[model samples]
Target: MLIHLAYTLTGDRRCAELQRMDSERLDMSGYAYYENIWGGGAESMFRRKASVVQHLDRLRVGEHSLFEIDDFIVNGGEGPGQQDEHRRLFAPAVDLNFRRFEQDRRAYLEGGAERQADEEAALMRWLPHCRRKLFFEWNAPELVNRLIPFLYLDTYLSLLRAERSTIEQVRRDLVLGLNRAFSHLYLTDSDNLYVTTQYLHSAEQPRPLVRLTIPLSGVDLFVDGRPDMAYDRERPDLLLRFAPPPALALRPGAPMPKLERWRLNLLTFEYLMRLAHGGTYNILADECELSVRALKDQLLSAFAYEPAEAGLIEFFVAERRRYVLKKIQIDEQGHLRSGG
Candidate 1:
């Protein structure tokens, strides 16, 4: 269905052909639905609160539970016509809680270099490959953007676990103790709800200017529903946010809006890391089919760094390391740093 939708949207023949050939090339039953690895049984911290993360495709309307698709469709919502399924697609919005990282927050804020390193190290323990460049850089290439939601989720999950929330609460609410490969769990009500966090520049100061954005694709609620002959695509892509929980008052004043870098919209940072490690620049430029100068421009654009600003990062990707990209980190002084 998604492949067909992609084809419909992009009018890409390749997407259409892939949908047509799906049965022959892919195992639908084994992979059609992602397992509820990030959720506990019903009664978790979310809307249902069943004490576990449940993955059944059931909906509860007040006291009555609706499971069958036809029945759900038959029931009418506040909207005219058969909009039960549409209305069932969402629920009341709720605020997300993440006020659990204050100690580490203070460490990162009050402590100096060692504290910053310790904080980052703690975060890495949860999602090791979470590259730092994504947050610090201006913007990202498209592929990287797709992973931003998952990465940010991990950042918070790390904090939640580090704070030692209850085993069950962490298991269910924080989405731990599960075989989840990715980090988001979409619920019927999740579309209406968004995650938010707050921090202080100091104990009394609110860090309001640093707008931490969850780079998300546009969402359009289809009132008319699509031609699938059943119902509408209900869920929105998972949206999330992670605060550096940095101090507000000391933050530098910048009149110009800064570009964000947490999405997959940038080139592989590993390319530059490779270059930095002594790979030939001209040779790599040739392999990627661009002149050294043109490649350099793209590289500069990827890093959002210019040598004059000391943000410029130079690198070399050895032949064997072509696909390897490194993570980008920002130091307290805003200098770019890379490791692991």
Candidate 2:
């Protein structure tokens, strides 16, 4: 899957020469593109949207009128799930200004609920496919595209080719293991070892959370040189994490790589897969405690050596994007073939 940004002006404007977005305000962007990672902002917040489109008078900058930006909407899908996967994505451009005056007139009638009801009825009357494009679009990721840096295209393409196999394995690991781990991380001991992705300090407390954090080297927990019985107990914001095995966990470096609180499924999958593979490929992280250095180290360590070009990276993870190896057959000699 791919995601891109589009912008348009909305809401009522009294004059032509409207102000542009401020740099500092735009700097405080709340974009969420990495579904597997929760970095506060919109991820922790609930979002609400209105279907109605906003209309504004033409913007004017000095004598000449500002460029008019029309609302654009796009919606399209293709083929069956089992087919050749000739899928296409279109963000379909639709114009919502057609009935601007009419909608305005309807706005005041009978408190406008009547017109709203009529519009809904009329939409229901039309062919279902026709209404797919009419939606009030809002994507925080797209809003902050201005702040996103461009990739070193040549270097990225080369690296993609060089590490295709590693990439494929990662995809498979994530696609198959994430949800499976989420369902079972708590089953490690059942009687103890709980995890909570919230805030609860371990410095000092009256009833301190009995959170067991396993380090990379240690297999057991000891409190004052004695086994700590992690009995089942109630504690708010408690988190039990199986910390990365030292060699596998990257140390924090400067110009830190920004990471988020682990999305539970991804975190669990990382741990379970590491256990299964007899090696760890990740580091533990807490929500609201992201380190840019750790992120940079993880990527560099994955390659064993640094590349020449500066890379631009974006995390894209979605459960719905799982892969299917359809119509494949394995030969007796351990060869693979596409059957269908």
Model 1: how far residue 339 lies from native, Å: 56
lDDT of 1 by residue, 266-323 (tens): 1112222233333334432333323223422332333221223233232212235232
Model 1 quality (TM-score)? 0.16
Highest TM-score: give the candidate number.
2
Off by over 4 Å in 2: 1-94, 100-116, 120-340
What are the lDDT figures for the candidates, one per model?
0.27, 0.26
Candidate 2 C-alpha lDDT tens digits along 1-340: 0111111222222223223222222311112122111212232222112111111111110112111111111111123631221111122112322343234323433345656776545433321122222112223223222121212222223323444554334433332232222222212222222221223233442111211222322222111122334544432221112333332334345233322122223233334344334333243323111332343234233323221212311111222443121233445576656533
lDDT for model 1, on a 0 to 1 scale? 0.27
Q: What TM-score, to 2 decimals, does candidate 2 have?
A: 0.17
